[model samples]
Target: MYTLLIVDDESIAVRGMKQGIVWSDLAITEILEAYNVKQAKQLFANHQIDIMICDIEMPGQNGIELLEWTRTHYPDTVSLFLTAHADFTYVQKALQLGSFDYILKPVKHEQLKDITGQAVLQWKKNEEKKTFSVLHKQYVQQWEEQLPHLIERFWQELLGERVLPKSKQIAAKLQQLNIPLTLDDQVLPILISIEMWKEEFNARDEEIMEYALRKTASELMLASWPGTVIQDRNGINLLLIYVKPTDPIIRDEVQKICEEYIRYCNQYFKCSLSCYIGESTKITEIPGMYSDLLVMERNNVSASNKVILANEQLQVRPFFDSSATSFPVMDWIMLFELGRKEELLEQMTESCTYMEQKSGFCKEDLESMHTSILFLLFSVFHKKGLSVYEAFPSKQLIDSTINIRTLEQFRTWMYKVISQGIGHFMLHAKEESEIVIKTKKYISEHIHQEFSREDIASYVFLNPSYLSRLFKKETGISLTDYILKERMNEAKRLLVQTEMKISQIAESLGYMNLSHFITMFKKVNGATPMNFRKKIQ
Candidate 1:
């Protein structure tokens, strides 16, 4: 329901408008009448007037003056002017006073009703916008309260590769999140690896202790510095320290802080920790440095509760040299090819134990061993007339092999890949035989239709690349070449057996363009389609 006010000096005009016009259809429940601006002001002060229809030439205070007052006091109230005169000056004055609309006197009832209806809609829209503004402010306040947690989540995504490492993108995000450091700043990465807890703890207790550890690290290690501490996906705590360019003593200060943190953890928390401090680099290089620290932590085989700098780890040769007797690569490959699963796994375990005992393996040795093992597997699979890609379709064999960083990761990846390969080889061998049979049947059935490797693979429910590899492995020819061979064979048969024209035969083989078909036939048969048909006939 809405209240409407009519201000005019003429009583008859106000009466006719109130009684003659059907106010109920416009949702105006109550109509308030006023003879002058003073009476209109009193009515407006008493009631919540949604719309005001005032005569422009009222006595004493005019409609323009009333509209001006309402514009300041009741800004949400929509106002319109009704005048008996078509004076351009009055319309100009009314419009300048912020009147919603102006209507000349001797008004039509329909036109007046239409203008009032629009005014009512405008009022409702204004109210709705006000409500939305309030809610929007409330929501923005809530987001501001959670800004810190959101910033931490963004950092976690940055380290986890969910966010790309572009400097401009990272800098813009930092500014938007109001982070104190910039990409141009030098940052040191500190990786804290928790070895063991002296006492037993439940999951909830462990979470609380981890939070306490982060707070302690920030308080002690970064008390005089600016830094951020985040727990990564591996549950390892890392601190990114920001330092001034002229601060030459910052490293020594940070080292002493880390030592104190280690001592405090062992004493109060009953947990042993090994700290891996990375070299200071720019913000964009932090991800690489973080990866290096992860590798160092995984490769640590020394005593716990110590600080290990990345440079020191790089200088020392902890694992055996590659020239030493590592693992029997050929023997392992032979066992794998022979399908001796138990013996193969045992041999792998024994080799890993021996490498751990020797304990001086470097990055190059790990990569070399990875390459050797992959080469051995590829050879065994090749000898068995199977492609590794066809045997294991889901695994990215090349990329995963290249990304092997530590000896432990290499060992785990090798064991998993070999084990999965052995299982898939047996299954895929039979599957590929069935696929080849089905593929041949499909090709022969659809020989007259335009189809591709994707269509054939879709029919057999296999990936196109995988199916192509399987077809080539079994048929000694690529899928495209084989399709062309089948099409040419059919063309020859049609030319020799049927009395169809060369164009008709080409169209029957799904070649919409006759020239393309002739070109292909010439390339394959060393003659045009008509030439081949005439020679055969």
Candidate 2:
């Protein structure tokens, strides 16, 4: 509903318009008439006029002057100029005065209806934009308020392997959450391993003290640089300092912080702990690096309030591997989970060959190797959420760890254990493979449609973000990267096998912009579509 004001020198002309046009059909509920600019100003002051249809030429004052005044005083009200003469000056000045439209004397009622209909649509759009602006501001404020919790949640997911930990994925998520870090950037991690509390405290009280220690570490250790103090699921507090990969002297400063941090914790918190600093590594490699630091911590059973630097010495060691990094426990766990059985066996055989060449390898060393292989089996089963009975149906398999008296026995035991473990993994992996196979099938069917992760997630009955994590965990590649690969593969096939134009192919593949399609094609295929076609021909 809107109000209208019609101003003209001729009362007959105004009356004629009032009678000719159906104001009710134009969404105008009330219409007012004014003979001159003064009367129009009075009407504008007293009434809520949404639109004004005014004649240009008047006896005392004209529509141009009235529109100029309306532009300053009531800017929301729109105007249209009406005149008998088609003078260039009238049209130019009418436009300069910000009138919605300039019309010659005789106008069709249907044309007027169309123009006013467009005007109402534009008005509604403008109102919607204003409302959107307010809503956008409100959302920004809420996101800022929740940013801390969001960052904490991101770290927890990343540590738990519930989020894809690739550079592009991490950077996009960080950008979406407005975090000030990139995954390509390197971070130096200091593992704060609390050995034992000197004073007795309940689990809840200890958790509170640990929280206080994390805050203290943030205030003291990270005061000089930008960093975060994160506590993992196991209640392991780690202070991650964001640094460049080429920044080699961070360890020097790390020593200073750890010395003070250790002293402060011992004196106030009444706990014995050690800070083991790792080399600067990319964000995607944080979990593996943190695991290595855990191995270093677990090996040092005698140290207390110490500042230990973990170099490549502990790189491939597992929690109970001691100093025997002969086999990469985590890497092998990753391989077994991905169902790479032959490669895993070959690697195990290679590790045994290397051990055979060494004269100092003894039963203790064999015990470390045994622990490493057992860790891989346990870790993979845990990740799949399977029971011990389901993983190893025979108690003999668990008890057989003690039968390994010599290198040959250890080798035999490992082969039997790994082969049995993989059998279970492959059976459960079929369930995961079903999901991956279903996802790939869905992507193949909708390659030409623009759909979101949420759309695919809903199809698979999973959460949107969780779908990406699951895909990456199972396939060793991000879901988005897999989709891009499929799209590019289809593009190559079309370019070589079909007679379609590049633009048509791009559009068929749901790429609206031809240049963007070319750029992406070049990025993926190392050649543009035209060049690819040329080579094919």
Which candidate should be chosen as best, given TM-score against the real structure? 2
C-alpha RMSD values across all candidates: 23.6, 24.3
TM-score for predicted model 2 compared with the true structure: 0.57
Find the number of clashing residue pairs for candidate 1.
7
lDDT of 1 by residue, 246-281 (tens): 763367777888999999999999887778899998
How far off is residue 486 in model 1, in Å?
A: 73
Q: Which window of 10 residues has the lowest lDDT sum in candidate 2? A: 314-323
| Ten-residue stretch with the least lDDT total in model 1 | 315-324
Tell me which residue pairs clash in candidate 2. Answer: none
TM-score of every candidate:
0.48, 0.57
**By lDDT, who's the top model here?**
1
Write the residue-wise lDDT of candidate 2 on 1-537 in tens digits.
Answer: 888888888888878877888878878888899999988999988998887888999887788888889989998787888888999999899888777786777867777666766666666676788899999999999989988778777777776683256777788887887765676677788888765555434344667888999999999998987778988655567888887544444578779988999899999998777788988877887777777776566445345577888753433332244345567776687678777788888888788878878765587777667767766765455444454467675554556657667778877877877888888888875465555777888999999987755567657644343355567677777676677788889999998889999999999988889998898789778999999899989
Q: Where is model 1 more than 4 Å wrong at Cα? A: 36-46, 56-69, 83-97, 161-187, 192-206, 212-227, 241-276, 280-285, 295-308, 312-537
